[model samples]
Target: MKAIQIATYNKNIIRALLGLKTVEKSAGSPGDDEVLVKMHAAPCNPSDIAFIQGTYNIVKSLPAVPGFEGAGTVVETGKNTGHLLGKKVSAFVQRDTDGTWAEFFVVHRDDLIVLKDEMDPDQAACFTVNPFTAYGLMEIALLRESKAVVQNAAGGQVAAFVRLMAAENGMEVINIVRKKESVDVLRQAGARHVLYENDEDFEQQLRGLCAELQATTAFDAVGGPLAGTIFNSLVPDAELVIYGGLSGKPVENLDVMGPIFQNKIISGFNLIDWKNELDAEDFEKISGFLQDKFIGGTYKTKIQGSTTLDKIVKGLRGYIANMSAGKILIRP
Candidate 1:
């Protein structure tokens, strides 16, 4: 089987791309609780980029396959996972073994989400990460009974799904984006409240909107001063949920008095952590709900383009250049 192999980790993205090579690899068999999936389509997500650069939370050894999630048909099932045979599934792998970037991937049965017959393969390719991240963030907001929420990196897919889920639950979203065009794009997508972070009066607008909407929950993906701004601007007792570090900086300019005097709180969100807290029954219930939304076309990941395994280096560069444009799929 052919797989995209990275022999070394490079913080410089260009060097990382230069290091990617497609090589013939021996396909490994599954164990008792595992299944072998014939890869259909995998996506280049931000997490994959970070993983390749050795900056992500979970890093495998050198010469590892980089994909974290994908969708495919289970061709070979282990003794304990026979029920998944011949099923179309969306799966994610966080193990040190080879990943979904190859023609064949072996993953534990617990990591698989059985896809609906109506779900598109391209969408399923991106199924595990962003959607679940958004779901977990919204669960925090809903648990707090928040009427509205604010999120930076609102142009990303997870933020897009958050907006849709908020609307469905009768909550509002105050979206913050860096570019003026994204403000327009989100508005055209029916986002009621969008803010351009570079605007001169951006802080003023965010503060006023937070008060008006009584938004106490903030999802912060880009750290740095922006996280502080959102943290300080929210109503008292608000919760700031930090998920991603896209800005590559620490949180700054935070008002110490808010946490000291007000009941404000800062927390971190991890998709795996959230998923672990749920039992099998609850996990299945939530997964079914989310999949139904996709089947109904209520949730969709924008797809910019696709490439074969041989052309992944070039395709991934395109994706890194314009991630907000959409995702780039790798078909094996």
Candidate 2:
């Protein structure tokens, strides 16, 4: 099997720090609840990037195969595995001992999620992380009965999913982006509140939009002072959910007094922790709903390009160059 193995950590230019090495290994016999998957495709996500950079909260060993989610076909299964052979599925490899960036991968049979056949490989490749994050976070908004929500990185793939899900749930989003052009792009995708982080009216527009829509939930991906701006812009006693640290910096400009004065809450949302607390039934229900939405409408993700195993460096660099161009797929 061939895999892109990261042997060293590089805070900057993480893609260059990783390498694709041809590794020879045996297909271990599956256990009663395990399956062997012939990998078809995997998407390079922001989490993967952070993993290789050695900055993610989870620490991986040296010579790590860093990847989170992907889709493939089940070629073999254990005795306990029932009726799942030869099925194409989306898989999440949560084992700290293993990763999915390879020609073949193994996972628990129960963890294999059969995907919609009509779905594209790129979409299936991204089946778990972004889509679920967007879907699950929206539930938080719904629970708060928030009329409107705000999120950063409006030009990102997950941001698109957030906007689409919000629209379906009767919630408006104040899409925040560093680039001015993203305002138009998000607007075309049905975002009514698009604010530029670099604009002089950034704070003004944010305050006005929060006041107008009564936004009570902020899904922040880009950290740094951007989070602070978002925290301060929301309605009273709102929730600020930090999901990603795209800026690779601390959340700045936070509403320090909100918790004390307005009873506001600031929390973090990690997919792994969220998944752990959920029962199997709830996980499936949430995953299924998000998958249906993804296959149905604006949930479709645009793919920038595809690459094979040998072109791993090119693929990683390309994705790092401009992630918003589209989701990059590794056709292993």
Which candidate comes out best when scored by TM-score?
A: 1
Q: How many backbone clashes does candidate 1 have?
A: 0
Q: For every candidate structure, what is the RMSD over all alpha carbons to the true structure, in angstroms?
A: 1.0, 1.9
In candidate 2, residue 126 scores what lDDT? 84
Structure candidate 1, residue pairs in collision: none
Tens digits of per-residue lDDT for model 2 on 1-332? 77767677677764434444545566556678888888888888888777777787777777667677788888888888757788888888767645788877878865568877777666888877788878778879999999999999888888888888888888888888887777787788667888889998889889999989999999989889989888888778899999999999998887678877877888888877877789999988887776777667647877899887778778878887877678888887
lDDT of 1 at 209: 99
Candidate 2, pairs of clashing residues: 228-253
Name the runs in model 1 displaced over 4 angstroms: none
